[model samples]
Target: MQIKALALALLGAASMAGAQETASTAMPDDMPPPPMAAMLRPPRPDSARPPEPPRENIAAPSRAVALIAAEAALAQCARDAHEVGVAVSDAGGHLLLGMTMDGARPGRIYSGSRKNAAAVAFAMPTSAVQARLQQGDAAMAARVKPWMVVFPGAVPLMAGDRLVGAIGVSGATAQQDEVCAAAGAAAVKGRL
Candidate 1:
């Protein structure tokens, strides 16, 4: 039994060695490596690749501008006797500034952020998005991502024909929240 085991081990080793030798000899030394071969290959024709979407030079609001927007929204909510959270997001839906008023619910901050993201995604106010959803627009409803909020509390910040950022407010009635967000956008209108 010991002899048989030893013989099998030797046979396996011999087969592996033979396979390795065969593989090595299959490719010439002058041939480039796999990665280099890919690099050397010509690019696929334009028709073979999907057309890329047009690129736009969109700008994002600066930190100072974002802060101004958030402060303005918060102040508007306060003036309406509402303690709310404010969130300012860049065009790419990244938080640029965030603020929560005293006595506001902690979840209001998250709500504000989600509203901002939704506004940016739809390139319009969350109120419009909510209206569309209510009208049973299936196409628009399908575009609502999990991380987005279609509530009426966010407004996009546009600089001329370009979108720069968005502001969102939460903790008040939907209309009140949208009013606060519009105030925020107005505050930084010239700067954005």
Candidate 2:
């Protein structure tokens, strides 16, 4: 009876050892034990990851388009009896074209350039920037005003979803300037 019991105990121990080996080998060596939530949740789709090889080049507005936009904005301001200054800047905030209506103040050129630079830097309409400032973004408002004007006189240019540059108008009321700047942005819409 003792020998029979010992044989059964040895067989049981061997089976337990074999089971442990099988369980360990069933999983990859590097895979961590899955979280409880992960086991219960569905697998994530592949689309969650961004596409490989991201876009390298950025599209920018051509010089001709900037000139045309500036001219158009200037003409629009003329119709309103406003002596406005218009400016266009590249994505890097470098001036591309600037124009002033015949009776516009000389100082308007400086304001227009500042507004354009602000629009490019912020990547939004200056009116939107003003709105954000008004809505209690004091830190941003303070940080940005030294280098660029934060009024409603400029807007970022977009070629589809891409930023191309910015257009700005000055020498008029903030609203009026915004209107002119918007016109300039519109003129170059389809042409990119």
Candidate 3:
């Protein structure tokens, strides 16, 4: 009737531009994954597996097992009549070996080297150094009494991280200076 209504208005404007170009090429069923900067990190720890040994650097327990445990702890403190003093030190404690036994007390060279240097500088075992010299704490009982030997025979020679020194047995009772410093750290347990 008017060019048949202008050909049905150009076929309903070309089917509404082909249904808006097929809904702009679709794709949206909830969508979400894709961003922690695109994900992938996990690999870092091998700068050459080799570097760890210092249990106090160990070792200082030798000096020919400090002269066979200061001659078997001064031959069992001369079988009880007691007169002793023995020493050995190195892992920074100094002295190598020192003796006295034959009726000690040449003024106990200052109480047997300050009680075996306060028992090898307090590595423990001299009855907690007589309960820290009975709690007066004279400056930490004088730090094993001048460089440690705290009686009951000073010890701790170890071998690995290498301390390799310290054994002190002083004249009798500290339980016979720990049985002659445990017979000089058990005659050097096969070189620790």
Candidate lDDT scores, in order, read 0.83, 0.79, 0.57
Residue 21, candidate 3: Cα error in Å is 75
Regions of candidate 1 where Cα sits further than 4 Å from its true position? 1-58
Runs with alpha carbons beyond 4 Å of true place in candidate 3: 1-49, 52-67, 81-117, 122-132, 141-152, 155-165, 168-175, 178-192
List the RMSD of every prediction in angstroms. 16.1, 22.1, 29.6
Residue-by-residue lDDT tens digits, candidate 2, 43-150: 768987567766345445798998889988888888888998888887766677888888788978768878877788789999988889889987767657454888
TM-score of each: 0.69, 0.67, 0.28
For model 3, how many clashes?
Answer: 27
TM-score of 1: 0.69
Candidate that would win on TM-score: 1
- Which pairs in model 2 have colliding backbones? none
Ranking by lDDT: 1, 2, 3
* Whole-structure CA lDDT of model 1: 0.83
Clashes of each: 0, 0, 27
Candidate 2's C-alpha lDDT?
A: 0.79
